[model samples]
Target: MSEPRLSSLRWRVTVRRHPSAFLLAVQLLSLVLYPLFDEMRGGRVVFGAFGVLALALAVWVVNRSPAIKWIAWLLAVPAFGFSLLSVLFASESLLVLSSALEAAVYFYAAGSLIAYMMSDHRVTSDELFAAGATFTLLAWGFAYVFVVCQAWYPGSFTGALNPGQPRSWLELLSLSFTNLSAVGLGDVIPLGSTARVLVMLEQLAGVGYLAAVVSRLIGLTLLRHERR
Candidate 1:
């Protein structure tokens, strides 16, 4: 085999071995890139390309998971397609629809990760990575929910940076992180009844996720160490 073939083979092996890790890395990388892209002209095109890549990686990760893989692809294909269409046509309705679908895809992926983690007894490296990936997935899911809510109810969210104005994607994401983590540290505040209700649900989800998933992982790790 040639050098390019060897490199490609290695990459494929790594992805198969630890697909969740790659998904987690892309999610984390987006945290840095999203804001930078927002500052650039024609950044929506770049953002759309990156989102497609992420969704493709997500579909791959879901395929390796315990959950039904085809469902994720079903949701993801239209989600990213709407996203791409929104970018190209600059249609607000398409953007909202895409966000809603993206949220569903993220939440489904998160649930898939939870199933993957719980299906086995041994604490493997991939399961560990899935834990983090699941958290980010939930956060992204709720952020997109916020996006849709803001569209439905204008002035639903306000931030220190731009009071009374519509929140940006980054700001909504920040709010999602803070609410999901139960930190309440973000400057973005959800004011409308719909937004507040969503925040409350996310808060409960954060606590429940930590209590259920993280606790189980730690307990299993400890039990394994003790048995050794």
Candidate 2:
């Protein structure tokens, strides 16, 4: 094969061999790129490119294990829908909504895939950490954006705060994430039942998922060590 062909074929094989790694790289890129181009122009391009790459990778993954088709299809449906809306939508608010939804889906997909790998107990430590770290990066970005944009939020981000809260957009974004991560920063106080409950949900999901998956990985590693 020519060099270009070889590289393309190699990526295919690599993705098929290591779906976790492929997903990790894509998730990491999405996290970093999302905030930098919140405007959606540059984001659309990157998102489309990643989508194409993911589809290609998915082809290999599905061929090897059709079971992954379930996950791949679920992730792809929203990702593709958001991408389409982001490109075709007439209103900026619609686009923003799509982008935000895409972030949630991406985070969930990354988390679920990592969870799957952890349960496999066959993935290498390097691959596991790399995937976990990528997922963490997305979580960090999501939380950071929530904090940075706190001031501009018109209502309770997670139904916890009021529209009149005196916050800058950045502050709200940061606080949203801080609450999401369950950091208990103690600065953004929830004034209503919705805010308090929302805080707990975000915190619980953020910490619980990571902790559960990380523990599973540790167990796998320990099991392997015992075997050796």
lDDT by residue for model 2 (91-166), tens? 4454455445445544544554555565555748445745454444445435433432332343444333544554
Highest lDDT: which candidate? 1
Residues 1-228, model 1: lDDT tens digits? 999999999998888888788888888887878877776543643464465457556666546544466677778788778888887788889888888988888888788789888987888998899899999989988988999999999989998986978988888888899899987697999899999999999999999999999899999999999999
Winning model by TM-score: 1
Give candidate 1's TM-score: 0.92
Name the runs in model 2 displaced over 4 angstroms.
Answer: 39-75, 82-93, 96-104, 107-111, 125-153, 157-195
The lDDT for every candidate, in the order shown, is: 0.83, 0.54
Query: Residue 157: error of model 2 in Å?
Result: 4.2
| TM-score for all models, in order of appearance | 0.92, 0.61
